[model samples]
Target chain A: MKEIAEKVVAGDVRTVARLIRDIDDGMPHVRDALKRLFPHTGRAYVIGITGAPGVGKSTLVDQMISHLRKNGKTVGVLAVDPTSPFSGGAILGDRVRMQRHSMDEGVFIRSLATRGHFGGLTQSTRSAIDVLDAMGKDYILVETVGVGQDEVDVVRSAHTTLIIVIPGMGDDIQAIKAGILEVGDIFVINKADRDGTDKTMSDLRLMIDMDQKKYKDGKWKPPILKTQAVFDQGVKELMDTIEEHRLYNFKTHGDLPFRKRKDRVGQELAEMVKARLIEEVIGGLVESGAFDMVVEEIVSGKLDPYTACERIVIPVLGKRP
Target chain B: MVQKRRLRVMVAKPGLDGHDRGARIIARAFRDAGFEVVYTGLHQTPEQIVDAAIQEDVDLIGLSSLAGAHRYLFPRVVEILRERKAEDIMVCGGGIVPEADIPVMKKAGLKEIFTPGTTLDSIVAWVNANVKPR
Candidate 1:
C-alpha cells in the first residue's frame, strides 16, 4: 500500500489508475491512499466543460487536450456521463472518440457515471480530481454529465467553467436553463461550420448583456467564441480565451487564493460527512439488524414508521438538542 | 451518500457488426448486478477499444462481436494493450465466438470468452473472481 501511494505521488500512471479505482470502488483502505495523496493535490488548473448533449462538448475537450499537450502541459480528463438514473449503468463512449491521446503517457482520462448519486456532483468526482491533481497534471478537464440544468455543481468544483453551445439552437437557445446560463466563464458556439452561426452568437451576446447582476461587480464578461471541434478550428482562440479568463481570475482573487481552497475544503468535508453518515451510521444499523425490530413492529401494524422512528429516535441519536 | 465499490466493465462492439442486442443485454445485466458498465457503440476499431479501456480505466473489456472477425480483431486489442504495458486490464469477449476458437483466442491473451447461451450471472461471477486488484 505504501509502495502504491509512493508511486501515485511520483505520478506513476498505473498506480494512479489503481488508486482511483480503489476510491471508486469504496475500498476500505481508500482513506489511507487519499491521505497520502492529499498533500500533493489542489495544484492542477481544474476546468469544467458543460453543455446540453450533442453540443460537441466532448469533441471540444478532445481538441483542447491536444492543444494543451502541444503547449507542453500534462493533462487529465474526467468525462462524466449520466448513468441510467434507474440502473446506475452508463454508456461512457466519450473516450472512444478521444482515442488520439490513448498512447500519450501525459494524459489520463477516466469516465465517471452519476451512479444514482446527484447534486450536480458525485462524491467520487472529488476523489478522482484529487488523484489527478496529485499525479502532477498541469491541467485537469472535468466534462460534466451533460444532463443539463442541475449540473451547476461544476461551477463550484471547477476554477473555470466552459459552456459549449452550438449554432442554430433556435428555441433551444432560449431554452438554456437559468442554472446553465449563470455558470459560464466562457461560452462556445460549436459546429460553427453550420449556418446561423452569427445569429447564434448574437443571441448569446444579447442574453449575456441582459444579465445585469452578473456584471454588477464588473469583474469579467463571459466571452462567446466559435469552434468546429471536429475539424479542430477556433480551439486555439478558445484556449487563449481560457488563459485570459484564468489570468483574470488570478488577478481578481489571487490575494485570497486560500479562500477558494477553503471553500473546496468545506465541500470535501461536507461530502465526507454525508458519506460517513450513510455508511457508518445508516448502513451499520441495517447490517446489524437494528432495523429488524423496527421492521417487525411496523409489519405487525401496531406501529407506524413515523411512530416507531419517534420511539427509537433518542436511542439512535442522542437528543436533537 | 456512500456508493458501493461497483466493478466497472466496458462492453464494446468492435468491427462493423451492428448486432447490438447481445451487447445491450450484457450492459444491462452488468448494471442490474450493481456494476457500472460503459458500452461503446457499434463499429469501433481495435484501436478505439484499447483507447476506451485506457481512458475509462475499466476493470474488464468485454468485446461483443458477431462479425466473425474476433479471431483477427480481438487479439489486436490484447496486443496493443500488451504493447502499452496495460496488461493489467482484463480482456473478454462475447457474441458468436466459436467454442473451438476460445482457447486459441485465450492463448493470444484474451482472458475469457462468452458466447450465446452464457448466463449474465456467470459472467458477473467470473469478473468478481478474476478482476485484477492492481
Candidate 2:
C-alpha cells in the first residue's frame, strides 16, 4: 500500500485507480493512502459542465477534452447519468457521445450513474474526483445529466461551473431552472447553428444584466460564449475564457493568504465530516444489524419508517437542544 | 480504521434510463446483506460507471440495463477495464437481459446475468461466495 501511494504521488493513473478502489471498498489502507497523497493534490483545476438535456453537454465535454489535450494537458471527465428502474442497469451511452476522444491517452473518462441515490451527485463522484486529482490531471471535467436543480448541486463542487444552454431552451424561467442565470462561472450557448439561438442569447444577456443590476457589487460578469459543438466552433474562445477566469482567481487570491487558508480549512473540514459520517453509517451501525432491525420493525408494522428513522438517528446523533 | 467488512457494491445506470425501482430494491437487498452501496444519480455514462467502480474499487460491477444499447455499452466498459489493465475486476449485470443473450454476454466477459425476479438472498450469496475482500 505504501508503494502504491508513493507511485500515485508521482502521478501514476493505475496506482491512483487502485487506491480509489480500495478507498471505495472501505479497505483499511485507504485512509493512509489518502494521507500520503494529500500533499500532491490541489494543483488540478475542476470544471463542471452542466445544462438541460439536449444541450450537447457531452459533445461539448468531448471537444473540451480534445482542446485541452492539444495544449499538452491531461484531462479527466466524469460523465453523470440517470439510473434505469425496470432493469437495474444503465445504457452507458455517454462514451458513444465522446467517441472522437476515446483513443486519447491524455484523456481519462468515467461515467457515473444515478442509480438508487437521489441527490444530483453520484455516490462515488467525490471518489472519482480524488482519483482524477491524484492522477495529476490538469483539468477535471464533470458532465452532469443536465436535469435542472440537481445539475446545480453537482456543479457547486467544481471550481468553475459552465452552464450550457441551447437557444430554444433559454426562456426567462428556464434561465433560472437550468441555474444558468445564477450559478455559472461561465455561460455557453451551444448548438448556436440551430434556430432561435440569437433570441436565447439575447434573453440570457438580459437576465445577466438584470442580475448585475440586482447585485451591483462590482463582481466580474460571467462570460457567455456562443458555439456550435458539432462543428467544434468557438471552442478556442471558450477555453480562453476559462483560462482568464483561472488567472483572475489566482492573481487575486494569491494576494489574500488568509482567504485561501480559510477555504482550504473549510474544504478539509467538510471532507472529514463526510468521511466520518460514511464510516459511521457503513461501519458503526449498518454492520451491526441495527439498521436491519429498524427495517424489520417498519416491515412488521411495529413502527413507521419515519418514526424508526427518528428513533435511530436521535440516539446516535444526540438531541439538537 | 474500521475493520473491513462486506464488499461495497454500487449498481448503477449509465444513461437516460429512468427505471430505478429495481436498482433501489437491489440497494436495499445489498444493505440487508451487509454490503455498503453508493448509488449514483441517473443518466450516467459508461465512463462515469467505470470511474465510480475504479474509485470505489468494489469487488464487483453490477449494471442494470433495460435499454437496448447495452450490447454496445457493456463492451466498451470491459474494454476500458482491459485497457487500464484492471481486467481482474468482476462484472455482472441484470435487468431484462434475455437468456439467449446471457451466453453471449458471459462470453464477452460478464460473469453473471440476473433476470427479473431474482431473489435478493441469491444475489447476496453469490457475491459473498464469489468476491472476497482484497
Candidate 3:
C-alpha cells in the first residue's frame, strides 16, 4: 500500500489508475492507500461542470482541457456517465469526446460510471479526486453525469461549479428550480450558435440578478458566458473567467479556501462515521438475530418503529436519548 | 462491502475508419453484458488508443476497423501496449480483415479476432472467459 501510494504521489499514471479502479470496485484495503494520500491532497483546484443530458457538457470539457493545457497547466479530468440499472454496467462514452487529449501526457482523462450512485456522481468520485490531486495535477475537472435539479452534489466537491445549458432547452425554468440554481459559480450557455442564445443569456442574467440580491459584500457572482464548444468559440474567455473565479476565491477565502475545505472534510468525516456505525452496530445486531426479531415484531404489528428503534438503541447505548 | 470485480473494456475505432456501426454495436453489447465499456469515437490513432487503454486500466481492448487497416492498426495497438509495458491489456480485433492476415495479427500479439458475422453473445462470452480484472 505504501509503495502504491508513493507511486501515485510521484505521478505514475498506471498506479494512479489502478488505485482509482480499486476505489471504484470498493475493494478492501483501499482505505489504507487513501489514508496515506490524504495529506497530499488539496493542492489541485477542483472545478465541476454539470447540466442536463445533451447540453454539450462533454464538448465544453474538451475545450476546457485544450485551453488549460495551452496555459501550461497539467490537468486531470473525471468524466462520469450513468450506469445501467438493469445490467450493473455503463457505456462510459464521455471519453469519446475528449479523445483528442488521450495522447497528451500533461492531461489525464478518466471515465467513471455512476454504478447505481445518484447525485450525478459515483460514490468513489471524491476519492478519485483525491487520487488525482495527489498525483500533482494543477487543475482537476470533474464533469458530472449530465445532471438535473437536486443532483447537485458537485457543489460540495468542487471549488467552482459551472452549470451548462444550451439555448432553447427550457433550462431557464430548470435554473429557477431549487437545487441546481443556487450551486453555480458560473453559468455557461454552450452551443451559443443556436437561435435562442440571446434569450437564454438574458434569462440567466435576470435570474442571477435576483439571486445576487441576497448576497453579502464581496460574495462571488456567478458570471454567465456564451460559448460554441464544438467550434471552440468563446472557450478562451471561459478559461479566463475560470481563472478569475479561482483568484477571487483565493482573495475572499485565503490561500486555500479554508472554509470550503473544512466543509468538504467535515462531510467526508460524517459519511465515514455513518458507514462505520452502520457496519459495526447495525451489522452486529443483524448478525446476533436481534434486528430480525425487531423486524418480525414490526411486521406483525406487535411493535412500532419508533419504539423498536428505542429498544434497539437502549441495549446498545444503555440509555434512551 | 465486497463488490464484484468488473471488467473494463475499450472499444476503439482505430485508424481512419469513418464507419463505426460495428464498434458502437459491440460497445453497447459489452455494456449489456455488465462490463464497463469505454468507447473511443471515430478516427483514433494507435497511440491514442494505447494511451487511453493504459490510463483507463482497461482489461481488454476491442479494435474495430472496417476500412481494411486492421492489419496495421490492430497490430500497432498491441505493439505500442507491449512497448509501454502494458501488454497485460488483452487486444482483440474485429471488422473487415481478411482471413490471410489473421496469422500476422496473432503473431503481433492480438489475442482474438472477430470477423464479420460473429455473434455479439459469442464475443461477450469470449471476453468473460478470457479476461479477468487485474
Candidate 4:
C-alpha cells in the first residue's frame, strides 16, 4: 500500500491507474493508500463540464486539454458515462472523442462508469479525483454523464462548473426551470454554427440578467460564451475564462479556497459516516434477523413504520430524552 | 462490503477502418454480458489504444479491423502493450483476417482471433472464461 501510494505521488501512471481501478471496485485496502495520498492532494484545480447528451462536452474538453498543455499545465480528465440499469454495464464512449490526448504524457484521461450511481458521477469519483490530484496533475477536469437538472453533484467537487447548452433545445423558460442553472460558473452555448445560436445566446443573457442581483456583493457573475467545439472555435476564450475564474477563487479565498474546500470535505465526511452506519449498524441488524422481524411486523400491521423506526433507533440511541 | 469486480474491456477499431458495425456489435455484447466496455470509435492507432487500455486498466482489448490492416495493426497493439509492461491486458481480434494468418497472429501475442460468423455469445463466453480483472 505504501509502495502504491508513493508511486502514485511520484506520478507513476500504471500505479495511479491501478489504484483508481481498485477505488472503483470498492477495494477496502485502498483506504490506506488514500490516507497516504490525502496530504498530496489539494494541488490540482478541478473543473467540471456538464451538459445534455450530444452537446459536445468531450470535444470541448479535448480542446481545453490541448490549450492547457500548451500553457505547460499537466492535466487529468475523468469522463463519466452511465451504466446500464439492466445489465450493470456501460459503454464508456466519451474517451473516443479525447483519444488524441492518450499518447500525451502531460495528459491523462480516464473514463468512469456511473455504476449504479445517479449523481452524474460514479461512487468512486471523489476518490478518483484525489488519486489524480495526488498524482501531481495541475488541472483535473471532470466531465459528468450528460446530465439532466438534478445531477448537480459535480458542483460540490469542482472549483468551477461549466454548464453547456446547445441551440434549439428550448427557450429561456427551460433554462430557468432547470435546477442546473444555479450551479454554473459559466454557461457555454456550443454548436454555435447551428441555426438557433443567436436565440440561445439571448435567452441565456436574459437569464443571467435576471439572476444578476445575487452577484451584487462582488460574487463572480457567470458569463455566457458561444462555441463551436467541433470546429475548435471559441474554445481559447473559454480557457481564458476558466483561468480567470481560478484566479478569482484564489484571490477571494486566499490561494487555498478554504470555504469551498471545507464544504467539499464536509460533504465527503458526511457521506463516509452514512456509509459506515449502513455497513456496520444496518448490516448487523440485517444479519441478526432483527431487521426482518421489524419488516414482518410492519407487513402484518402490528407496527407502523414510525414506531418501528423508533424501536430500531431507540435501541441504538438508548432512549432519547 | 466487498463488491464483485467487473471486467473492463476496450473495443477499438484500429487503423483506418471506417466500418465499425462489427466493433459496435461486440461492444454492445460485452456490455450485455456485464462488462464495462470502452469503445474507442473508428480509426485509432495502436499507441492510442494501448495508452487508453492502460489508463482504463481494462482487462482486454478487442481489436476489430475490416480494412485488412489487421496483420499490422492487431499485433502492433500487443507489441506496444508488451513494451509498456502492460501485456497483462489480453488482445483479441475479429473481422476479415484469413484463416491462414491466425496462427501467425497467435504467435505474435494476440490471445485469440475471431473471424466472421463468430457468435457474440461465444465471444462473451470466451471472455468470461479467460479475462480476470487485475
Candidate 5:
C-alpha cells in the first residue's frame, strides 16, 4: 500500500488509476493508500465544466487542455459519463473528443460513469480528484455527465466552475438554472460562430446584471465569454480569464474556506458515525434477532413503526430517561 | 487463482471500421453480465486502444474489426500492450473476419475469435472462466 501510494504520488499513471479504481470500489487498501497520499494533495487547481447535453462541453474542454498545455502546465481530466439506466453501463465518450492528448505524458485523463451516484459523478469523484492531485497535476478538469437544472453537485466540489451554453438553445433559461447560477464562476457561450449568438449573449448579459446578489458578497463577478471551440477561437482569453480567477481566488479565499473546511470535517464525522451505528452497532444487535422480533410484530400488523421505535429503538440507543 | 473482482473489458474498434453492431452487442452483453465494459467510439487507432486499456486498467480487450484490418490492426494492439508491459491483458476479436485467417490471428496472440453466430452468453462464460484478477 505504501509503495502504491508512493508510485501514485510519483505520478505513475497505472498506479494512480489503480488507486482511484480501488477507492471507487471501496476496497480496503484505499484508506491506507489515501492516508499516505493525503499530505501531497491540495496543490492542483480543480476546474469543473458543466452544461446541458450537446452544449459542446467536451469540445471546450479539449481546447482548454490545449491552452493549458501550451503554457506548460500538467493537466488531469476526470470526464464523467451517465450510466445507461437499462444496461448499468456507460459509453465514456468525452475521452474520445479529447483523444489528441491521449498520449501526452503531461496529461492524464480518466473517464467515469455516473454509476447511480448523485451530482453527475461517481460517488468517489472526490477521491479520484485527490489521487490526481497527489499525482502532481497543475490543473484538474472535471467535466460532468451533462447537466440539468439540479446537476450542480459536481460543480460545488470544484474551486472554479464553468457553465457552458450554446447559441439558439434558449440560452436565458440555462443561464439561470437556479442551481448552476449559484455555482457558475464563469459562463462560456460556445459555438459562437452559429446564428443567434448576439441574442444569447445579450440575454446572458442582462441576466448577469439582474443577479446582483451574486456580486454583492465580495464574490467575483462571473465573466461571460464567447468561443468557437471547434475552431479554437477565443480560447486563449478563456485561459487568461481562468488564470485571473485563480490569482483572485488566492488573494481572497486564501487556499480554502474555513467554514467549508469545518463543514467537511463535520460531514465526514457524521458519515463515520452513521456507518458505525448502522453497520457495526445496530447491525450486530439486529443479527441477534432483536430486530426480527420487531419485524415480526410489524409483519402481523400488531405494532406500528412508531411504537416499534419506542420498544426496539430504546435498547439500541443504549441510554435514555 | 481466481480473485473476486469485476472484470474490466474494453470493446474497441480499431481503424476505420464503421460497422459497430458486433462491438455494441458484445459491450452490452458484458455489461448485463456484470462486467465493467468501456466501449471506445469508432475510428480508434491501435495506440489509442492500448492507451485506453492501460488507463482503464482493463483485464481484457475485445477487439472488433469488420474492415479486414484485424490482420493488421489486432496484432498492432497486442504489440503495443507488450511494449507497454501490459501483455497480461487478454485480447479477443469479433466481426467479419475470414475463417481461414483466424488461425494466423490467434498465432499473433488474439486469445479467441467470435464470429457472426457466436452467442453473447458463451463469451461471458469464457471471460468469467479466463479473466485474471489479483
Candidate 6:
C-alpha cells in the first residue's frame, strides 16, 4: 500500500485508483497513505462545471477539456452521478460524450455517484482530486450532478465554477436564480446556436446586473459568456475568462477562495478521524454481536431506530471503567 | 483451502437520470451482504464507469439505469469493458429493468439483471455464484 501510495503521488492512475478503493473500504493504511501524499497535492488548478439538467453541461465540459489539452494542460475530470435504488449501481453514462479522450495519458476521467449525498458531489470526488493533483495535472475539472443545490455545493469546492445554461429555458434562469445563480464564478450560455440565444443572454445579463446591486462593494462579478459547446465556439474565450477570474482572485483577494489548501487538508484529517472512530466502535459492536442484536430489535419492533441508536451510542458515550 | 478474494462491486448511475432512491437503498443492502461496494454518483458515462472498474480492479460492474437508456447504453459499456481487458469482470445491471429487456442485456454480456423489488439475498447469491475472483 505504501508503494502504491508513492506511485500514486508520482501520478500513476492505476495506483491512485487502487489507493482510493482502499480508502473507500476504510482500510487501515488509507489515512496514512493520504497523509504521506498530502504534500504532493494543491498544485493542480481545480475548475468546477455545474448547471441545471438538460443544459448540455457535459457537452460544454467535453469542449473545455479539449481546449485545455490544446493548451498543453493535463486535465482530470470528476463527473458525479446519482446511484440507482434497485440495482445498487449508477447510471453514469455521461462519459459517452468524451470518449475521444478515454486513452489520453494526459487526461484522467473518474465518475463518482452522489448516492443521495444531496451535495451533488461525491465524497470520493475530493479523494480523486487528490490523485489527480499528485499526478501533477495542470487542471482538474469537477462536474456535479446538475440538480441545482448539489451542483452549487459541489462547485463551491472548485477554484472556478462555470455554470452552464442553455437558451430557451426562461424557467432555468428563474430556477438557477432561486438556487445557485450567485455561486457561479463564470456563467456559460451554452448551445448558443440554439433558439432564443440572444434573449437568454440578455436576460442573464440583466439578472447579473440586478444581483450585483445587492453587494455594495464591487466584489466578485461573475462573467456571463455565450458559447456553443458542440461547435467549440467561444471555448477559448471561456477558458480565458476562467483564467482571468483566477488572476483576479490572486490579484485582489491575494488568494483564491476555491483553493483553500488548509481547509481541504483539515477536512481530510477530520473525515479520517471520524471514519476511524466509527470503524473502531462498529467493529467492536459487530464483534460483540451488538449489531445483530440491534437488527433483531428493529425486526421485532422492540426498539425503534432512533432509540436503537441510543442503545449503541450510550455504551460508547459512557467512559470506560 | 484457497480462500476467495472478497468480491468488490461498483454500482453507478450514468446520464441525466435523477431517480436514485433505489441505488442508495441497494448500496446499504450490499454492504450488509458483505460486498465492498464503490458507488459512482449519478450521470456517469460508459468510459468513466469502465475506467473506474478497471482502476478498482473490481470483480463486478453493477449498473443501474432507470431512465430507459439501458438498451442503447448497456451494450456500449460492455464494449468498453472488453476493450479495457476487463471483460472477465462480470457485468450486471438493475434499476427499473423491464423483464422484456433482460434478454437483450444478457445478450450484451450482462450476466444478471435485477429489477425493482428484487431482494438483496438474490443479488448476493448471484454474485457468489457467477463471479470468479481473480
Best by TM-score: 4
lDDT tens readout by residue for model 5, A1-321? 889988998888888877767765546567788878878888888899988778888888999999999889999998877766776655666776887787888998887766643221323677788899899999999998445532466556677888888889784456456556767788899989999889988877877888787688677998999999999998888988988888887888676842246665575446445543454444555658777887898999999988877765677777663
Comparing 2 and 5 by DockQ, which wins? 5
The digit string of per-residue lDDT tens for model 1 on A97-152 reads 67667668888888777665434245677778888988899899999744543356
Q: Write down the lDDT of every candidate, Cα atoms only.
A: 0.79, 0.70, 0.85, 0.86, 0.78, 0.74
Candidate ranking under DockQ, highest first, comes to 4, 3, 1, 5, 2, 6
Docking class of 3: medium
User: Which lDDT tens digits does candidate 6 get at residues A160-196?
Assistant: 8888888898987898888787778888988888899
Off by over 4 Å in 4: A117-123, A146-150, A171-176, A257-260, A279-321
Worst ten in a row by lDDT for model 2 chain A: A115-124
Categorize the docking of model 1.
acceptable
Give the Cα RMSD of candidate 6: 8.4
DockQ of 6: 0.09
TM-scores of the models, in the given order? 0.83, 0.68, 0.90, 0.92, 0.85, 0.68
Question: Residue B2 of candidate 6: its Cα lDDT?
Answer: 12
True lDDT of residue B52, candidate 2: 58
Chain A vs native chain A, TM-score per candidate: 0.86, 0.83, 0.86, 0.88, 0.82, 0.82
Clashing pairs in 3: none
- Which candidate wins on lDDT? 4
Can you tell me which runs of candidate 1 are displaced by over 4 Å? Answer: A118-121, A146-150, A168-175, A195-199, A216-218, A255-264, A289-317, B1-3, B13-29, B32-34, B40-55, B65-69, B79-88, B95-100, B114-134
Residue A82's lDDT in candidate 3: 77
Clashes of each: 1, 31, 0, 0, 0, 35
**Per-candidate fnat, comma-separated:** 0.50, 0.10, 0.76, 0.78, 0.33, 0.05
Task: Report the lDDT tens digits of candidate 3 across residue range A1-321.
Answer: 999999999999999999999988767688899999988988899998988788899999999999889889999999888789899888999998999999999999999887753231333788899899999999999987445422366445788889888888774446445567787888899989899989888888887788666666878888899998999999988988998998888887787643246776687667666555555567678767888999999999999999998887777777776
Could you give candidate 2's per-residue lDDT for residues A83-132 as a string of tens digits?
55543444434654675464455776665555443331332465567667
Candidate with the larger lDDT of 2 and 5: 5
- DockQ, per model, reads 0.45, 0.11, 0.58, 0.65, 0.39, 0.09
Per-model C-alpha RMSD: 3.9, 7.9, 3.2, 2.8, 4.3, 8.4
Task: Give the winner by TM-score: 2 or 4.
Answer: 4
